[model samples]
Target: MTRSESPDLSVRQRLHPSSPFFNAARHLKKLILPAIVVFLVAQAASWERWLFLFVVPSILYEIYRFFTVRFHFATGEMVVRDGWLFNNERHIPFERIQNIDFTQTLLQRWCGVAEVRLQTASGQEPEAVLRVLAVPVVEEMRRRVFEFGEQAGAEVPPDLTTGWESREREFEVEDDGSPSPAPVSDRLLLHLPPAALMKLGLIKNRGLGLVLAGMGLAWEFDLWERFDFVEKVRPWFSDATWQRIVLLVAGTVLAGFACLLLFSLVWTFFRLYDFRLTRHGDDFRLQCGMTTRLSATVPLHRIQFVSVQETVLHRAMGAVSLQVETAGGKSEGEENASMSRRWFAPLVTPGQLTDLVAEIRPGLSLEGLDWQGLDAVGRRRLRRRALFLALLLSAGLALLFRPWGGLAIAILVPYALLHSAREGMFLAFSHFAGGIAYRSGAFTRRTSVTFHDKSQVISLHESPFDRRYAMASLHVDTAGAGTAGHRIQIPYLSRGVAKSLGEELATQAEQAAFRWS
Candidate 1:
């Protein structure tokens, strides 16, 4: 059991002295790179060599930060005092803190220190960053924060808390040959072994991305001419026969694909080695990576929604990826994809889906929820859109191939209608138990859900097409929705029903307490 009383909050703490070294290392390029123009002028004017020290300003600033910054806890919150000339003090409430992440780069690990990031709602970056702290101290800070939060009616059950620490754990190691720095709770939900990681690499085949990276690397090193890459390939166009050219191109493409796949596998192995997800009281903690270790905690109450993704390959392997959105941090854009993907339990099977879902939001499940499918108007609209696409394709082909291409419409219309029928059949949504769910796509399926407690805005949107068809789209937006992945929007509802549903959702949201509460 955790103490309701604060844990030694009286004493102020300073960051580890090694913070400057890490700071300097981060800006090593700026610190070490000489200004060619400045040096030339200095030499011409016969100025003293000490002027060069200006380039090391970043390193010196880091040294200044080492002496100036201090932090401590007070009045159910954490306070940080930083700088002298630009003295800044921030007071962050423990309850408002949505996520906590710890990062240990290779250098930080060697020095037995980790960087801690405290994130609040709405901002794109962490609210407070503690540069470098000893492993034990960092763990203690995390423990106190969660313990205090749990006491403040965060609704983490006492029974659940008891279950975590009492369970067994898989082995974890540290640079000092001690246990993992976090002193993690023992309710390990998922662990990714090498075999499973290999499957993930193949499933998310980012081989095409390798082509761009290869081009960039070649340009960076100016290796094209030295390798005679262009000259070597000229014969494929100028000297080779048509059959020989086709064979060469096919062979080269196949070889390149294989090479890229192999590279992706190796890269995935390094990036996601020793992945583990554990429960720490009401929070889920994910720890992974090889060269640069990462530990992130998402409180159960902070989760705005959960999404399940199953591409064609995922179905073939009987696997599905689960992602959750919290208050801030990775709620949008590229950072959203990069940060959220790391949380996916790479090897999760179909049978494991329900259990995992329940673990995050107790009693929540994708199965057994009453799903509503597209209505007659919705299906007709979808078919109309498909027909429009068919007409465009037929017209483009007709322009290219005259009368023969005009015959393409006969085949295109039937195929388009059939595909649209399938699309309409699959589009579904359900609202129940103070929560909303939406499912979209035919081939690559995506399902997302959010509860009223976390719901921010309920919008009834109508486009020109929607108006023409007497239909509307009901969008349920949440606090931490990321682009594309966090889709709670249910489209193609009859306008009247859409209006009613939107009103009900808005009323429910108004009555509900804030998620953090």
Candidate 2:
């Protein structure tokens, strides 16, 4: 049933009957260890078998929730009433609903249902998550939400994405002197083929998590003992010939490194397979994943911050990753959310960065802006600070190891000086008519941009050391910028400049951002 017309929305509707099962399944991961604990304890005491009593209620609670939860699309708001006993009723305004996305696991896809997630700028979690809904119902909900949004005069940002300069896209104007929304083309922004994904897997180096998983599996299944890893390898080190020893050692190291790279590649593929990003007016849709397909739409206006991230490896490969921090998408710390945002455009070439950034936020450019760097005093301060840290480290090591500890000074001092010198070149900040941008990191460069219209708070931060050197950090804070995995923070500016910039941005934000509410 489409179930999406005006009359269908006016009355309260229960989630699909399968919702209770999906809700139960969502909690299964949390219950795994506890089930194991109960089962093991049952072997000792028959009374412990009753612990399933605890497990039963936890599993069946969602059944109660299924019976209780009721949602209605009301005038200008979606009202969700849940938990008959505790009784929570939420009226989420339509305009504030930033995204209405769908996620379908393999099982859900099989069941012909999907989880419906509604999000706002309030927090990391989705404002409302309907455990499971029929595919048609979910589609209807999404359509109605956006339809109501447009009816309320929510204008889609024109040319906010790519193809802006070459094209002028307007609403389909009606003969009655009213503009109606048109079906905009889903302009393909970027798509990752397998070759590029493999390259990204190499550059991203996500093998650590895989390595840890391998170790856990080995521990769990007693694979270490099964293979006799230690005892088998001991003979190569103990009694093998010098040439044989070298060969075995080389072989072992190569095998381990190869496994690590392979794991990284596999992990990247699982997470980023068939990655496609498309833009339809202000909304940018990201679809990815090999097994569990996800379709997420991020509106342009909700985007609070944007960042270009590059590691040393990425730079060497002449590539970078583009990340967008929407007003609220997902928590930065969450693996799933982090992955989606992190790989927003996992592999971007220098040529793509400018056009891509311009699409995300019009008038924001990476090229030929009046960039300012940390001057000589700031450089000296960073060097001196590094040298001081090195000295303390050397002194501590010398006290501990006596003679060999002084060798640390030789290694650390030069490294510190080199690092400071590199920062002098790479670390810079620019404040222009469009927005404020910061370029930081000597080895792992990051360039972040936030427009004045997006800036929420402007402040200057100074430590005692900063005060001593007359240096401070100016931060242009926006809503959810912290969780977006980037910030518009320009460090090591002269105190005067920091204050001036802070005041300037604050004034600009007040004038531009105040209209939003």
Candidate 3:
């Protein structure tokens, strides 16, 4: 049934054939308990009979809303007409729709329906949310919406050169429901060797610290406890000489350290056990979830950029963490949007990481990888700047503390210089080939890769210090992931490279303006 011939005249236009009041009343029953309690309280705490007049009007206003609200969804726009005495209508074009999120609460699940939220770039209260139909209907609506978008030049067809048609057609079924399929490749994108898995487990996760602390608390409650090795050994050396006592103490300390290392190893392995990644057509499939099963198929081109991060410890261990950025992929609030979810590789060899990237993105190729090696001149300059800054900071600290000033300054300089030099070397180490690679760290080292297509906005700037160094920082913004926005800061690059790269990125984006699905 088409929308034009519908007899639901009260609704000038409707996305679906149901009345908004029908949906609202179905949901309004949920408020009955609270509403009844409020009414009883109002009756008992009444100051005057006039107060009852206000309550009566408030009740009528809610009742009026129960029957008056109307919403409509068209191919190109979604419109909502609401309110009582004052009427307001909101129309959102499909092109402006950032995402269509469908959520089913426990109650909504029982009723076999879900809520469809239309989020756009426009900042508004309540957003454009609608109570909608079943999951299949939502999927169908999404597909139809995409078809409508194609008409308005909002989406580009996938490149046929990539053999996407055969892959896409595999999932296709005609209106009559005949089978159309393609051969599934058994080739894997990643294979985790047992040694790699063991190394991955030894890495520290911020969450693991909390988990271990919780376990220790539980041990105090008799849920578990460490073996009392010290108590057992003390009796054995109760009457021993001073030399024997010292030897026993040293052995106990060594044993305790071993136990701690063993525990950490066990914890890491279990968290990352049997980790695997596979590619199915243009989608990257990740199947992992320890307590809860998780399976997500991320569209390849949808990835905004890729980030490889490491800490001081990780760098020494020869491992880097990789994060794939995408738009509107987070399920949490704005604060956690920048973080990774269901995507982590505790330890991967550099060669393995390169292979993974090549498999996932054909255009992402890093050739002549030797630029990651810093020259002697660059290293010396970095160390010098670090040492000079450290001395200046120590002098400032000496001025603040007088009595122990010498001792304080003595300890601060070396510590700061070492930390600064390490960080300086980390940032200066970068390589660019298929795309641009910039590795950065002070505490946590990270290498971010920005592809030609994914680079949306590129800007350059030079501080006074940068001007003296004959360098500038290039800021590259992509389409997805992170809280603030898609950005990568590459510092100390030549001014020419920064400006030229920015111009090239802008041109590529313009050429591929409508290339997203």
Candidate 4:
């Protein structure tokens, strides 16, 4: 049979529908806050008799939305139609499509459905989402969307439907699935084990966040006055037993820290459960999460930069985290925090990191490069800046708190010297075959690799201090590197070196292939 004669062809042409229950749940989720407000207003105003006016309309609207929502492909574009009163429609062309991500909540997995998000280079939220579709349908859509090489008259494989049905049967056969053979082209890159995930949690700086959250909650509930720990403990301890008091305070602090660490471990386990990275064709796919499963696809050519991050703890353990910057930036704030901008390989050894980078970008290597350090003048400038800032901070503190704050100068001076030394030791830069790498940070070292050709702008910057020292900084900008604007910053280089490097990068960028989409 020709492609049009195949049953799968009919499926492809047909307008795909979303799950009714999924629509209901989504509508309910949206109305929850409004419903609460309405309930409260009705109670206060003694308008309980009119509650049905709100409830009935909401239910009816959700039912209408469930039936009206539909999507179909037409004329090389995907058309999505939804909304009741508004009648919203979005037509997205195939070429505008950048990435297609799939996600499944625990409930959706149980129902054998998934949510597909279509991302474009618009730097906004997803262009479109197939909210709820059967697993087979989702897979088929993905194949059709990504496999642009297939001809318009191309026939669907005869076994395509059968293969999907077989997969479904296997899923139904067991709680997880039958042990199946791996795909021919798919290669596993890295899988974070339970121990490694735990380490990631331990190394993460969650203590400050937790402390801030606790303080906010205490203030909100006015709990500080109700059970003040210092007040309560002070009454129980004898003023004369100074050593005992010191020991008690230290024990309490240790216990609190232990609790925070335990919380971090549990949080990390759930956040990054069963993390796995795999490569297929020109794309790298990452799958992770516990309650909510996330699948993100990153095309090799679209990756603007790759970063290898190592906190002090991670370095001590010989481990690092890998992240990549793609063309489209994620939305701002915590709402989109879980979105796909930061695809993480939680904990990988240094050797494994090198292998992973090479796998993602064949010519790119993370090791054995000759790194260049800052000049002596630049190092001295940094030290001077650190000392100046420390003195300013000490002065402000002393003015605010008198005697106790004056002691801060003693602590700040040494801390500033140590920090400056660490920065000088840590900062370095190097040029690779197709890209340049900038390494920075003291406690948490970060190495960012960006292609010279993909750079949107290359410029040399010099402050008054840098000018006096005959030094300059080179900045390279790219679209995907988030709010920082500059993707690569090689600070503290000689003026001549900076100018030459900038010119070289500009020339390379002009000659390199530019493909954002």
Query: Using Cα atoms with residue i matched to residue i, what is each candidate's TM-score against the true structure?
Result: 0.79, 0.81, 0.54, 0.80
Separately for all candidates shown, the number of backbone clashes (residues 3 or more apart, or on different chains) is: 0, 0, 2, 0
* Model number with the top TM-score: 2
Model 1 misplaced stretches (Cα beyond 4 Å): 1-10, 27-64, 153-185, 213-232, 330-344, 387-421
lDDT of 3 by residue, 1-517 (tens): 1235232222342333332433555445545543544454445545533443444454554456545556655646656677767777676666665544444444554555555665443443224555545544555445444445545543444222112222235446454377544334423566456576656555653345655755665554333323355576668788999898888789887886666666766655553444556554454545432332222334555565677766666778787666776555344454223222225344566776777677656645443344444445445656677677767776776677865564665776677667666767667433353455666666776666766566666778898977876777777776654532224776666777667766766676567553333
* Cα lDDT tens digits for candidate 2, 235-332: 76787789998897799889988888998899788767878787765567777776665667676677777888888989888889888776665563
Give candidate 3 misplaced runs (Cα > 4 Å): 1-188, 191-201, 207-275, 315-318, 329-346, 370-381, 392-402, 405-411, 419-434, 442-444, 481-487, 500-517
Q: What are the clashing pairs of model 4?
A: none
Candidate 1 lands at a TM-score of 0.79
lDDT for each residue of candidate 1 in 313-404, tens digit (9 for 90 to 100): 88888888888777666543453233433465666877677888889777887897899998787888889989999999999999899979
Worst 10 residues of 1 by lDDT: 161-170
Q: List the global CA lDDT of all models.
A: 0.75, 0.74, 0.54, 0.70
- Report the C-alpha lDDT of model 4 over 360-475, residue by residue, as the tens digit: 67867878667888667767878998999999999999999996897899999999998888888878898767878888877778888888667888888998978887889999
Residue 205 lDDT in candidate 3 = 37
Error of 2 at 347 (Å): 2.0
Task: Tell me how far the alpha carbon of residue 199 in candidate 3 is from the true structure, in angstroms, after superposition.
Answer: 4.6
Clashing pairs in 3: 15-73, 310-445
- State which candidate has the highest lDDT: 1
